[model samples]
Target: MTKTIPNYLRIHRGIDRQDSTNREQSQNLITSFWNSYSDATGWRIDSRASRKNNVLELLPAVTSETPQDHSDEFTPVVGRIAATRLATAASNLTEQVLRTRECLRQREAELASSAAMIGVEHDGKVSADQIEQSLADAMEACKCDAAALYMLDEDTRYLKARSVVGLPIERLENPPRELRGSRGDLEAMVQDVVTIDNMTAGSIDTWNSPEPFAAGICVAIKVDDIPIGTLWLFRETTTEFGSTESAIARLVATNLSLLLRQAPQAEIFDNPQPHQAIQEIAQWQYESLPVGSALAEGWRVDGMIESSESWATGWHHWDVLPDGTLMLAIAEATDPTATGAMHAAVARAALAAHSGYRHTPAQLIQRVSDTLWQTNTGEQLVSMTYAHLDPETGDGIVSSAGSISALISSRYGYRPLISSLSAPLNTSMDSNAANHEFHMLEGETLLAYSKGFATAGADQMTLGGHIRTAMQLEDRSPLAMLRRKLIDLPLTQERGALTLLRT
Candidate 1:
């Protein structure tokens, strides 16, 4: 053997040496990469990203509570005012802006006056007598023959009369909390205002106040995006609710809501300017109801959010484009105060303003980042999940910023998903960040949420377990499921938002 080594034996020895060299080199390279990468960026890209990520997109796991739409158009018309519609010229733009500004100023003044008239800003407490007097005052303030204030029952669905003024004697004697039976045409939770000149011909039974009522205006009163009650101004005459009239009624209704949300009947009886008043103002200022009419059919979205800070903003929104693309998004502010909420709202307004140039979530996030930076509001970071899901295929293109992720369930169990950590909508981050697309099989649903949910969540595992069961059920509802998981937490306040999307 020593005299003559065979060629096969010689080749095997060489291959073993080569394999050893390659292993040593690979180990050295990985070590150097980790050290250099962490030192340079202050973070490490997960090794798992190589396995889960495609070239550009990601799939997250989340839905609704419906978010308020942030459209710039405001009109103080018969029902509502378009907020800001740009004009052709800087001069014309200046004039139009002035016009809009004046309208809002007048509108706000009217609201403040009407709310103040209801004894909202009084130094003393609120009473049944005070509320009844306010209803009477509101009717007179709006120059209507009658007014009724229906507060949301604990169920937060049916509006029962908390106070009533100027109704038929019979209705006043036996006031029905429910204005009408089961509603399909209009979701009371989503609608802001309604005006009917003629009750019978309006085609909505809910709007028909009652017999002997010829016209009426109805307004929803909400706090922190949750509807608490409704204010209705009924007129025996056939006159319509003009723009001024509608705006006045809405202002009165809005402040009335603030009064209720701030002064529990007890607090109202105790103090006029409750500490919660400022927070309520901030929350309601930019936060509004989503334009449900713009959503596509067969899709329902719901969201639940709690803010620890008065300025903290949690929002959910969805809209349909000209070409049938459905976009849904939920956002949370990092600062957890009104300033943070304002940042989130500004980000949303920027997104809506440039919607013409953005179709996908990627483009939208990128544009939003740019807008924030350009507007100098990029200091406060906002975490968000924006996605487009095709109802036909149940496949979705999801773009995320910060700690947004998705979940999908298989027979084995629930799996958390995301390729890697992406930059939040910040001036410091790269605008060319990638988006991920998730293709789902039958029975798999997606959940999207702010990372804060993880921090606020009392039982993270229980939340997942509930969501898993919901996914497996034939008649699953994301709203009911999310409410169950997040409701009645040990913590008095939470700063997180959640949204769900289904096939």
Candidate 2:
């Protein structure tokens, strides 16, 4: 296919032109043609293109007064010779582009290698200083005389110079903030890569540079496409950056972004206070839930929970009455951020007191709610789902304190076991308690879960509806398979207890 590639729109333009020698050769050939037919032709090479059809045309820049004067004599031999030069020029420019791309790919692979090496170590691997050192090494590899690394503060939009070589601190401290009141050039952070040769004052803020400004490249350090900071490299001579230089800068920015992103983990690990606190809370959060096994005559019940850094859930102890009623409750604190172990413990005690054979699922939750009101359970509220099942008859009853609805799967169909939403635990006893009853066919399953389970691990409606449609009548794997799938989901950070009863 032919690209227009006018003389002005040629690939060999500015810094992108790689084959200066070939371009000069092509220009000489055109001049030679004008000299050969100088007196015979008013022909000049006016419009020109490095053609894609394996050919080149040196038209006579004149009226058709002498239309057939020179065509017969020179057209055949000149066309062949011109084709050779055209191919050479095109091939050279094409090679330049390919070379730039290959270099960038190699740089990316090198960055990945650096990341893998750092990933092997824990505490010292992702520190901010490590990032600065890595970036400095990258600067050396990129062959820049001077470079600086800037990282955004935890709460501030402006960037601060973290590390630098061959640059003054006063001028390089802040690049740009992409804000109105900020002092630096906003384009430095907003654009992909900005390069300027012979930079002056006010334009790029190179006015304060120690040596006379020459050339510079700036790129934003981005994570998941959002700019976090800027990386700058400067040269001492008047030379514009090419694609290869810009690409290397981008790759360096990417590596810096990843390192900065992981820096928080390093900080947490190096500081013993937050480290110990995280370990303790993580232990309490996971160990607080009973996920092993809950089995009785004609019932097989099991559950699991996974929490993010921000939220955790505690499940009430399972109840297996003498009548083979398998009861399970999953609870989440009203304030999603609070990891309220003591509050969950109090609610579990109340639930255990009434979860025996005498009380129905609705009645048991009602009693727990009343206890929360009367006792010193504080102003805390909890959302919970309590479900009890008689696996022998495939019969079950479910009650919720504004918890997620249960999912029922069988040969008939698979979907969320729809139920009415109700008040949470610690509500007034007078508030109505809603109950949902469900029956399962042979080899069917009933899965009850907390609010976190509904959304975190997967889309609530989509997962439930998929289970409903794909459920097998004789499947034995209850919630275990579902739990594993949930754990693999990116959004499953706050996934809570999931209890399943199989008939």
Candidate 3:
């Protein structure tokens, strides 16, 4: 079929005639003719692509303009050409729109799946093996070829690859160094852009991808403001990532970071365990007490013994020896700063108690003194007090260093026990050690505590006064007296420790 040229090109050629001094008049006439023809034939003229050379080929051989002999030939050819071109244009537009819609649908499905995997339901991995399986499922669902999960190292400065799919797990187990440079050739190789598929890499900017990895996205795994590691997806195509896909990847990373952070703290000694360990630790002290008679009948061990360097808990203890002649023992409970200091004291105590050397309390007290140091706010240390009651004897020894008051009393009445007021041990190691020794006369009570006791919440909760009054009302048995006071006092809510001794 002979195809007629578009009418706009014919008008353009006709208007450009060199003889026309009236260029505007000629162009207007040609435009008017084409417009009238287009209206009658339902054809539209596009002037943008008009050219003089193509004018004859573009003009429509419409019925009204046909010559008598050639009309049959030209008209049918022009009509057929118009029909074919329109069908081709329409088909091309439909195909382009369909492809665009499909891309959107694929991205939406990927996002929904990612959200479901890491959604409110917390169980992603049931076992160590399942972690890899979960990550693999995410990668597969996302249509990424390679994926990796890295953990923030203990120092938190960098991320180390822990689990991966499409890479050897053995190599990912640990990167030589999480830092980019120190990660060496294999890691550094991956960091450089190896494919055109990712936004993180481009013609102007490059980032590493895995070996044999052509393209994909790399998203940082983060929780709160902390960046734990990275999640990487790799593929063969030059995959241009969309905003929604990037967000879904980041969400997966956050879920992974949260799970890893809590795993260790939950399993460690930081939490409560069976009483077996506590019982074993206190076995020696338990054996030293009287067997037949109730050592302190009804004097319940209120809670599990807690270890500390602070003198607040008198039940917890450590042995001390410095320069052989100084043998000392400390018993206390945990404070906010107790964990580290208690461990230090435990090491010192264990060595002293086990060392085959003569021990004098004087030498030990001298070595165990305190030292001054600036606080976080640059303030001086607070006052602290120390007192010792020999487990073997009911005798009490006391020392005070800008500390709370000490109380000594028999069943009938109470009196303040005095010790030479001196600087705390660590404040000045060479300072004179103050020592007060007195036998806990049978049926008498002795108490020493931190300032928390006096500052306790309620008037009736004053630890010192309560213990004194309880002693004054002491039952025939020492155990009954302690049990009565323990159950009756309001000291639990306020922060303080009370160590009671009776002969």
Candidate 4:
């Protein structure tokens, strides 16, 4: 093939000549012929090589003459050479395309397998132990003295330590740092990677780690373009991290992000024995149900709980205050074990205890937040909706935190009521809760539910449509109907909801 290329080029260069006036036109004509040939053959020849002293450049220039007039003594040789070059180019282009496709297929297969294995290992739930193990592995990979992973809370306002190795958890989470300020973690997240040569320079907030030494590297853990958390590697000596260390840290952070994205509801506490765990889970489930429905003048209130898991952390409550105000609450903890149930219980108790204070919905949420902080349970992820309603006028104010869903449905239609963004309860010391004021018209109802409702194949929009369809019927017990519909769906987690109807 190499010998033929040179011979072909030499023979083609000897037979082509045209006037300078027609030279440019001849070159364009030659280029057009090759381009047409390439299109017909579906081969992408290099344009630069084609323009150079190649076989295609030696074609006889076309003029105002017959086809036979352009044919020369070298016609047979030129035809043979062009055929050979086209055949070789086509083979090489096909081989290159196949190789590129194979590489892409291999990469896709690897990613798919990784995702499948992750799903199988965690079973859609990442535990505290798993995160801690990941931190330890990352520390070992980076050859660091300690490692830690800090994830944003529900509000994305503070970075809380999700897992730690070679450092006290309390020291890392004593006071969670804000996500907006000029800190090492924030810088790493914004800049992709950051290194700190001095730990006490105030640029990197170490939370005053005990026995902390000199240097550290912070790598942002993100899923796609969204920043989820930061991975930190600490060294005892003041040494800068090399490219290899930084790269390994990035890989570890990427894997951790996959786990985090897959399992947003992480178990943050130690797992008990299977038997003890089952028993505690059962106890939590039993205690999560509301005592009964609330009754007031011209008001109807009811709630339901459904779960297929061994434990569910959803609860509902309603109480009538001395001033004829109806207090309603629905909450679910993100933890999937007994710990989550305990957190939900704490939130429920806080709401019940403060119902008599005649506080507005926002004020009541703040008080509950304060209670959670005082009880040392403010760090847990809990979504809740608390409301205060006047039974006489059906006027109400509701506040939601985290992902709790709420809407108002009537004969007309249904629309979401909680649009304000707020972090889940206990996520922050200062709860920046927003209050949504609404008036429940006659024959209208308020529905508040947990994450399981959406996870069970029904989103707020779908549920609204369903409610609209159900309202067309003359059924007095719409809540029961909706509960039955939800029960029929495949269960993935705990589902809890409460409905307040003004008749």
Best-matching candidate per lDDT = 4
Per-residue error (Å), model 3, residue 460: 11
lDDT of 2 at 439: 79
TM-score for each candidate, following the candidate numbering: 0.42, 0.46, 0.33, 0.44
Kindly give the number of clashing pairs for every candidate: 39, 4, 23, 0
lDDT of 4 by residue, 21-57 (tens): 3322223433565555544443334435554333332
lDDT of 2 at 477: 56
For each candidate, the alpha-carbon lDDT, in order, equals 0.56, 0.58, 0.43, 0.67
How well is each residue in 1-503 modelled by candidate 3, as lDDT tens digits?
99999644532111122523331122343346555645454444444654463332234434455676775455443363674465346446656755754444333222222222332332222233444565676577667766765544545455555566665434343443444533322232244212235433333223444333445666655555444455666664445556655566656655655544443334444544436654554454334322222224222111112222222223222222243111223233223342323333443344344344553344444433322231122222233334444544555455444343456655556666643334543444363555566666656655544443333342323444555666666643433444354554444422333344343
Which residue pairs in candidate 4 have backbone atoms (N, alpha carbon, C) closer than 3 angstroms, thus clashing?
Answer: none
TM-score-wise, the better of 1 and 2 is 2
Candidate 1 lands at a TM-score of 0.42
Cα RMSD (Å) per model?
41.9, 16.9, 24.0, 23.4
Better of 2 and 4 by TM-score: 2
- The sequence of per-residue lDDT tens digits that candidate 2 reaches over residues 261-374 is 564455556653435665676677567666556476545566665655533545645767777677667776665444465566667778767765487777877787777778
- Residue 382 local lDDT, model 2: 68
Top TM-score prediction, candidate number: 2
Q: After superposition, how far is residue 330 of candidate 1 from its true place, in Å?
A: 1.4
Sort by lDDT, best first.
4, 2, 1, 3
Please give the distance, in angstroms, between residue 39's alpha carbon in candidate 1 and its true position after superposition. Answer: 79
Model 3 alpha-carbon drift over 4 Å, by segment:
1-335, 338-340, 343-363, 370-397, 400-405, 418-422, 437-439, 458-461, 472-503
